[model samples]
Target chain A: MAITVIPRGDVPLGQEHEFFKFVCPPTFGGGPVDAQPATIKFARKLDVMADLPLPAGVKTYNGGNSLRLWLIADPNDSSSNGATFPAKTIRTKKGDVVWVDTGFSFNTHTIHWHGIEPTPMNDGVGHTSFEVSGNFTYQFATNTAGTYIYHCHKNTVLHFIMGLYGLFVVDPPQGPKFAAANAPGAFGFDPVNFSVPIDVEAAWVPGEFDSIWNDLGHNAFMQKCDQNDPAGAGTFTQNGFLNRFRPDIVHITGVVSVPGNPITDPRVSVAAKTNQNILVRLVHAGYTVQEYTLGLDATVIGEDGHPLGVPPFDKYSFPFVIPANTPFRLTSARRYDLLLNSPNAGVFPFQVKFMDWINGTVYQTAQTTVTVV
Target chain B: MKRRDFVKVGLAGMSAVVVGSMEIPPLFRCVARAANLAFDMSFTEALVEMIDKTQVYHWLFSADAGFATTGPSLPGPTIIATYGDKITINFTNNLPQPHGFRIVGTSIGTGVIPNVNKAPANKFTLTFTAPPPGTYLYIDPFYEPVNRILGLHGAFISLPKGGNTPYGGKTTPNVQQLFNDLGSTPQFPGDPWLPPPANRSLIWLFHQVDPWFNARAQAGIFINPDTLKAKFLPRYFLISGKTGAFASDVPNISIVGNIGEPHLIRILNAGLANHSPHLHANHFYVLSKNLVVQNNVLNIDTFTVGPLDTVDWLVPMIRPPDIPGLKSTPLRQLIPHELTTVLYTLQSPLMYPMHCHMEMSQTAAGGNYPQGLITHMIFTGDVDKVPFPV
Candidate 1:
């Protein structure tokens, strides 16, 4: 059985930009310096990104500034985790549990389950509190199917600065990972359907440091010099918003670090030999308006996480652009169940594109090189 | 000491055009005669007679040349003394603002501290017994933030006790021999290649300043007292306490031409960043800094110093005194050329500078102050090396 995938691309930037001041030495609380994970128990405190018509001109190119948050997680905080829905390319059978554990200070992550509504508790941000630093489980019941996304909601700036968001899909049948575990006489009332996992969660970001360290206030000296003399008109700048969202590379593997791993790594370094082709599921997790179009530039064996009416196993190309600000449902996080016919013997390089406003710097992210012996 | 050595001219009714381009500016020169070489220094205290008294704004600079003792444009005066001699430097502040000077390292013998502007000028006395042989800088921390901008400094050269030269290396009859053994940069062409013939010396001071604005960011700060208004916003820079065409008044370093002798360049830095100071036509070796350096390989062009960093470059001998290029100048043509022709001198000898490195630091903000930064190392054409281009 294959898992069904969806792309809940249309997201709303309700109350897009926010600023919070944090004084050092804790003017209010000389309290604990390291608060493992901050809690978002109040619904009013968290902002939602969902279906909304953004300014047409504001494409991925003008991926503006980022919101910064300092998250210190306690030893246990899975309850504090937020959730998302799925991407538009997964199809599955049934009875498979897709689990996503929220980590802290590591990456920016927040989850949203767009299509499958399970009340606000499963919404992730202000709805449920899995409490980060601790572990929580989301079971993708083989009953429903849809698309969604997951990302860091609290202290988002820090998370996004590092890259932590993804897409997911769900199918009514059991996933492939669980199929091998099924026993010989396991079929009872209605045969149980399992699904497969197609891993695709990547992010591309370049000019990482310049955007992080820029401080707008420090440019005073430069400004003063320019005022006294007219020599430098536009060539130099003294001040600007510090560490504003200005990424040059938009990576696909979800992970920005080199050498992505197929299993744990959004930095996926694949582990396989020739004659083996694996399917992959992708998710969208950024604030800027995205028209995510995924074209295999190869073949189409599956759609929406499952086999098409008559699967075109032959080499082909299909491009699907995910709308901006998508959500991730828990069930879709598992994987997209697509059959791989013939695998490429060597690792092939892949990539993705993102836009930054005007001086749209850092636009392309390196793709994972799939390795097959 | 016999006479015919120096011709001191009062800077009045005399002005010369910038003789050359940045690439080849006139090189003014000066020679330090051998006799009465010891610096005449004294520590005295004075009370400001009135509130309207002239203000003392002295700019200061320092250099750290590893271990060897060298001279400084501080040519102002040497705080001379024998090893073991007790010395006291008393500073009297005639102007406003707080001031203090503390030597970097040791308390006495080794380091020195300047006068404090806070205490009435008559109150403090810097006392200490001179220590081991070495050249060190005595800094004035007085209103330190600003005093350095206005120069207030001198050199501390202690003479060797018994029968020894004030210098540390093995004894030699002249300063050149001390330079040869345990020295820094060697000699090259022109007035640079050979050592000065032990003559009376003068300082070639170099420094920087801003014509307008201070911490307050005020505009057109430097003004004329008579009109109590800024005459012109000076975007100009300076060396040896002057700027513009007027800067020519500052003396140059020169010597009687000796084709094979080397000369000294005592360079200093005041505040104002950006400096890639260079000398034209000649390449020099840096020998004695605050002290001399070991493993002295010559050829030093441009070295950097932030604000008050001091450095020394050795001018070497390139041509023999018989070269016709050097024969025309009055000292050589009007006068007779002789051996050690490198001892060239103008009516009076002086040392000009290569030029300041802070690109625009040499010019005024807009094209306002026409007299950009320039100085010359004057020498009488009679000296030995190839005659300097007219």
Candidate 2:
């Protein structure tokens, strides 16, 4: 039976809407992920892997503001021939629309989305319009299709550093082949609802911030003066998807000292337990397009947020495209989710490279890992 | 004629014309112009002397004493007055250790004051006739650690200077001059209506610690004793007070944690040592430093809390969950209570620093005292914002 991959969506809410309930079943002590079945089940609790809660709060959007995108899934992704799997990929259109409901306090943001052409009002920018803080909805649609980035276009001292940025992808030239009567039976599906991004931007990798000399321009920020984050991961572990609510400060005065912050953010451990084989809708949100190598050797079953014909991430030059300043973000909370199936446990690492044709290195964060069962 | 003859003629003609009339700037003229703009903004620390070493202490008055670094060292007397009456302090010292002060308020009016090892005792005592209504501090070069420590640091008690007048900044000036007044004539300054760290009609002392470099380095460098051994290594980590400020509390001084009520603790690191001093819960702000305090500092849960750092915290602020609608389960409030307060503000509950900044300093003979290297901005009664309902 062909399988599928995407973020388990619509994390159901409790009647009382307790803050803790909405939070990822906290790492270790966190209680539960109230998401619907798909979002709630923790990658099949197995003893081989430690059970961890997923940091949570799915993307919410307001009405009037809407998002449109293609949802593609993969049955057998190439990156996972080595990984145990019952996985699938979800794909989006050349121009997809996602919405943002300024329904909550943290939702107040200006959308700096990449890859598509959005109507001025739908596009998330303060200069163009007002901020969608509470129940106000903002809509956006992507026209420039390629891997891109999105973030709150607000006056952020460091919003992205506060873990605000997300990667988005558009339609790749090649995509998944949905089952048709000509060949297969109606395929079963995995319950991931949203398009999740799995861009391996070192910031989420499980490794200590050993420094990436490859990102030449940033070498100065990584000089030998050390804080032994490697010898011990301490309470801080760089891994998995970040939190949609809180933000982790990434740099201070240009220094790349991971764990060099409010010490340990509980989000990492939280994200570890809740979600699984979720779509890592990859996008290029940085100034330069990156050569994001999942340092953990993840198989690429999908490209540009879409499942490919045969997933090996075989499309080398099919660059994850993000135009310089295009506002290609979601209108109705629509996001491009990547398809993944990581049966392997523990934090899987990844290295991000800003492949700027200028013969250089990719700036990186402490290696982040996505713990899976 | 040769072309050479023509060239010589043109040159001679141009030279004669120029010499007779044209007045263009010369290279040296440009150099001189630049030189005129070049200003070597020098500074210096205060220096006290016994002349005979027989005098118990030499009194300093701001009016007579030049408390700036770019001019004289022991230039004059103390600028003295009552607690509430405002005053101006002017100084000059063309040496090093740019002078600074450690008073409280808006971080303005910080000129070159001295922080020298040989500071005048009482730093040229400006005995306030009385104490101000609130806690106040005054030092030279108001922004750093070295200048605020050692002998340069002093306290100001602005009590009812005139008929027990309370703190209304608008009260009439006091007539009584506390201890020493350099003179009745005002020193070099203007009005006190300006912002903080600057007060007209105030006292100024110099907290000078010679070898300012050591204290300055402590704030920046991390000493890994594991990597460097004593006597065998050249990197001396000792700053201000020569030795043991971090290892030992100020000798003979017993600092109290919490009195009867919520206490307000003000820790100033105007010395040379980079101190990762932690207190029990209570967020703090680095009020003034670098001679000017910027508004850059907001509510800080825990900071490096280093040299030249000034933190003012309220001890009695309530722990949350004490009010209605807010979750106040003991476990829930534990972390914030522990990390955010003065007692174990940084631990996991009340959340104190699991590991202090400079992580290395958190240890003594390889073990943490938790209390020794730690402090508390303790609260006493009626915790202010406890969010849980009865």
- lDDT score, residue B339, model 1? 16
TM-score, first chain, each model: 0.40, 0.32
Tell me the spans in candidate 2 whose CA falls farther than 4 Å from its real position: A1-373, B1-262, B277-280, B285-297, B304-306, B309-311, B314-316, B320-356, B364-368, B377-381, B384-390
Report the lDDT of model 2 for residue A351.
36
Q: Mind giving the per-residue lDDT tens digits that candidate 1 earns over B156-178?
A: 44444533223444332333433
lDDT of 2 by residue, A1-373 (tens): 2111111111112211111111111111111111111211111100011111112321113211111111111213344221111111123543343443333223234444432333223334332233443333333443323344444433221232222344344443232222100101112332232122332211121111111111112011111111222111121211211111111212211122243122134323213333343434433222222333342333333332223221111111111223222222211112223333444566544333332111123333323345555
lDDT of 2 at B80: 23
Q: What is the lDDT of residue B46 in candidate 2?
A: 31
Q: Best by DockQ, which number? A: 2
